[model samples]
Target: MHTERSAAAADRHVGDVDLTHWRSRAGRRIAGAWAALGKRYGAMPLLLLTLAVGVGIAVLATWIASEVYDAVREADDVAVLDRPVLDWALTLRSPTGDRLVTWWTDIAGTIGMPIVALGFLVGFTVQRRAWTPLVLLVAASGGSLLMTIAGKDLIGRARPPLSDAVPPYESSPSFPSGHTLNATVIVGTIVYLLLLRQSRVVTRVWTIVVGTLFVLSVGASRVFLGHHWLTDVLAAWALGLAWLALVITAHRLYLTALHRGAEPEPGALGRS
Candidate 1:
């Protein structure tokens, strides 16, 4: 009886070991997958390429738009997208709309993006997880800033002919709007981050919906407030979307790198 009991206990011990081994193997696989994804999306070369391409496109577009401005200077109605829908959007002025526009533009330009970049740094340090998101964020913002200044100087297109309320700030180039670009970066970054963390369809839908609304609102506000022309806003959106695509591509590269055991640096995306 004693021998039989000992044999049964030995069998149970072996089973437990097998179960633990399987669990460990599964955990490692999951970790490996996550690491791979990060590396694939967050590599330095990939991100740099993305930034280069985006800046290059911005330069090209700005130059072309400047040519258009020169040719169309004599036209009284020179707006490209002059639909009533957009015009109505331009005229949507309420005290609340004005306040919201001012608030979002101020926050996005000044604090919101910086804070988000900081959060990515903090999270990366604490969690030792993905850090590529932050890198792309910094690249987008810094590149956008450089491109904006150069474009403004080069293009020098005046703001839209204002018939309604005048902007508090001096209007510069009417080809690409800084406010619109910043809005897209801030909101687009938010959307990309959400895609990273949320896998559920419903959750992603909500995130995208809310994010889109916010971005569009900010862009529209600039036009409505007479701060930017319709073409300027549209150009900004196009440039911002292209930059965002690059970021997403970089993110995928980071994921692949993570799988290869290469850890990314903190604050990769927090360039101010």
Candidate 2:
């Protein structure tokens, strides 16, 4: 009886070892198959997903901007606040404050903002020895410019009267403030790109906070300087966010395609 029991126990131990070894092999094979499947069929799905997200953002932003336009055109309830906001902004103005705000707001003007964006692009491109950064910057800033032009021309909303505004007046259509929109897109994009390389928590936090403050300050400066109505800045913020979403979505798809072993596009981010 002892001899028979010893043989059975030995057989059971061997069987247990075999089972564990089989399980380990099966797990590795499953993981390999999954990775292979992703490499084979992931690009198209990623492209489709990004397209859906971009379209959704564009549609929502357009709808919101249209609603604001209609309100302004019809002098609806929201439009009524425009005058009061401008009046209040005007009340806050003084010689020193005007100079400071004007100086700050100019940093986001057509010439100034482009210079700022170009500097960032050049610096990043040189540091990484890559053109992806430049490509992304161009796509973001170019789209923003086109959107600003279309919005301003479409709405043809005039700026607040010069009498109510500070000196160095603008004559452009003011439904969407170009300065605010451009600043938001450029600064926000820079922050997004910066965060990709940053691992430290403190650095990431400061990047986000500073970027947010810059965008908000640019928008507020537009109102305080009398270059745009309150609604103009609001609409610009909405539109800028939408464009930024589209840009980031495209970048993500690019990265996903590269990960799946798809042929890389020219100037795609190698480090990403």
Candidate 3:
């Protein structure tokens, strides 16, 4: 009877161990599910955070422009250099420089922005049957245009004097350089969408670097050709970066939410 009791106790102990093991496994599974959900929905918070940061930088640019526009309330001695820089640019003019500047400037304007975006937009949509390219183009074009117009009007900071400006003078408020802003958005969007279809890390990196250089060169051309002040270009750069970041981040969050695990490589968006 004692031996029988021992055997029964041992069996009960084994049953308890099994029960504990299953309970632990169930607990771990519940924890893992909660973690996965948190990871998936986490982008919502990230989106809000990015939105705040981007908008904050844009508003900050406006504020800085306001301070600079107020002559008596000048924020720094930097404003003292505006005309000097313009004079230097005017002095640096040459046939070669003029040609280069004109070429670079147009690249961000009628020739480059619209053509590249539209060409890729059609290609991507036809090949992939996805509207992402179109969406990106619209966002970049519409958003940059609206922001440029609104910021210019609100700031009302006059462009450099007509005498100081290059030919085909643009008579618009110049708190933020429209060329710089538009170039950033258009070139940036193209690079981003193209990168989505690419796979080679080196190719991706090189594309980004080249695109960035183009954008920066465009901004410099504006300042060099006396179309805008250094501050105007600076403000445009900051604001444009903010807008681009917002767009890219929002798109990424959208993709993450869609549960598409593997992202397509950057290419022409053709059928794989």
Candidate 4:
């Protein structure tokens, strides 16, 4: 009877060991699957590549724009559309027209203010992170302002004559419009952030519509207020667009990295 009991005990011990081995093997397989998925679809590397290309394009556009601006300033009646464009921009001055133009500009400019507010709101509403979009927006605004100042200092292009009734506080070169650049940055970033958050198509459509109206109104206001030449507004629009592209590229990379469990890169906030 004692010999039989010993053999039964040995058999039970063997079965327990087998069960432990099988469970260990299954756990490793599960861990390997997760690692493989991460390796295949992470967004970090793509973000880095996009940022490099965007910065390159912005530099090229700014350089070419400066050269073209200088050439036009020196020539008499060059292939420039300064006066004609300005005239078109300013025709909305009949009593009713003035009201319409004023209303649009005010309304459009107001749309950008919420972005500043939204930056703070993000901390409460989304991630509870304060420094993210706020830092980016501030950086974009400062970069635009600095570029405007530098361009004005280098070119020193004159405004139209006294008959044109230049805008109050207008000074320096008529090459790039600062107001337009500011408008673009403020409106552009807001639209970008909103698109990322919203799921409904209608929300995205409204965001785009508001952003477009804001940018156009700000650029047009510069001409209407006689603060910038038509070319100035055009250049600012182009330059601002280029700046915005770089900013967006950087933001995309940051977001991609973020999605990939990486930290957001410095200088990806749109500063030069």
Candidate 5:
């Protein structure tokens, strides 16, 4: 009986040890998976981001119909906010307000935006030595430029009438605001890429707020100055946001592939 009791105890102890070991292994596996997912999406879920991209594209489509097809849709209705918004915008006219709006517009312009974006990219790449962000910046800037040009040329939507516009008018098509699009792409990309490296919650929130405010201000300046219709600015917001989201998704996927030790092949969908 004594020998049997001792044998029973030994078996129970061995079983407990095995169970504990398995539990620990399972825990580590689960944690690692979550970590991997976090790395891939910057702590955001992949499904949610993809869904947002889809929504943005849909909104952009509505704008295209309104501007490109001249479809009767509320989204395309320049009159939607024309009278009220323009009336209100006129209230902001003054030497000081004009200066501020012009400053914002100038900074969001082609030359100004590219300088700011490339400057940040150079600094960011220098700090991290990661080819991932460099590739992302190039793609985002190039894609934004191409889209803006194509939209302007193909849509051929005329800018607001000269009577409504302030001085220094633009001659390009006005389906989408170039200043708004450039601002959203450059500011949005900068905030997204930089925020990925920021670990502090407060800092991240502040970064997003500042970026958003800047983009919105640029768009508002365009409308307030009568450069682009409100609808045009809205379309640019949707377009730029969609493009920015796509850029971020690509970057996340790049990070995930890198984490898995995948060899980035030439002429493939990934980079160094």
Candidate 6:
């Protein structure tokens, strides 16, 4: 009985070792295959990876936005808070506050946001002499505009009644707040570009803080001015963030590919 037990124990130990060894060998084979593919294809693999991730982000955003749209259409869940929030905003209104918010909000208006983005793009192009800022701005703005137009047209959500709105009332469909979405994308992209050039912790922190404040204030202004419901602004925030993530991810992947393909500088090797 003792001899039989020892034989069984040895067999179990041998099986465990063989399993681990097989796993190690399989892992090495997979790694070797990936390395060989990378060498042969250069940056194509990175580009393909970026494209896959971008598509996933877009699909996820679309799914979430659709859920919000359905809820709004059904007037349940988040849609229930719209009227209460709008009523609260109505109570806080004043001539001075309206004027101030209108002025600030206009800075992110359809016309205003494009102008601001263009000015920044030109300045960054001249300063950095690179097309990255332009690419980021265009991608961010274009995607934001497309999503805004599509959401508004598809949802066709009505804005607050004209009686409740501030002067110079908007006539467009107001499901996803265009002002809020544009502000988020443009401001976010600009901050991202700036951070790429900025190394100081304090400066980066301030940049992020200011950018966040600008986005929040714009979304709030839309509600306060009676141009959009709370849910519209919320949807715009989520959609804008999704688009921004896609842009940043693509940019990061591009940079990774560039760095991976570049040769080492003289005397730089082994220094790090």
Model 2 / residue 211 / CA error / Å: 0.5
Measured with C-alpha atoms, the lDDT of residue 123 in candidate 3 is 83
TM-score of every prediction relative to native: 0.66, 0.76, 0.70, 0.64, 0.71, 0.76
Better of 3 and 4 by TM-score: 3
Clashes of 1: 32
**What residue runs in model 6 are displaced by over 4 Å at the alpha carbon?**
1-60, 262-272
Tens digits of per-residue lDDT for model 3 on 1-272? Answer: 12211211222222123211224576446334433543555423433444455455555565655555565325656567677788888888998988879887987775677887788788866755544556657766767776787678777878888877778788888878988998888788888776766657788888899999998998888888888998788778877887887777555443433232223322323342
Count of backbone collisions in candidate 5 = 0
lDDT winner, 1 or 2: 2
lDDT per residue, candidate 1, 1-272, as tens digits? 12211211222222123211224576557445545544555445544664577667766765676666556655735554534435676556778877777776664554765776567556633332334445566777776676567657876777755665344565566557776776686568757665544546788788889888877877776777677777677777877776666555444434434335544444342321
Per-residue lDDT of model 4, residues 128-232, tens digit only: 222345545655665566667666766677776545533234456776776676677667866765565556778788888988887887788767756667787
Clashing pairs in 5: none
For candidate 6, the lDDT comes to: 0.71
User: Clashing pairs in model 3?
Assistant: 196-265, 196-266, 197-265, 197-266, 197-267, 198-265, 198-266, 198-267
RMSD of every candidate to native, in Å, equals: 12.9, 14.8, 16.0, 17.1, 14.1, 14.7
At residue 74, give the lDDT of candidate 1: 53
Per-residue C-alpha lDDT of model 5 across residues 103-207, encoded as one tens digit per residue: 778898877888898899898666554444566677677667766776777678777788877888888888778889878887898997767666677888899
Question: Candidate 3: minimum summed lDDT over ten consecutive residues — where?
Answer: 1-10
Q: Kindly report which residue stretches of model 3 are placed more than 4 angstroms away from their true locations once superposed.
A: 1-73, 110-112, 260-272
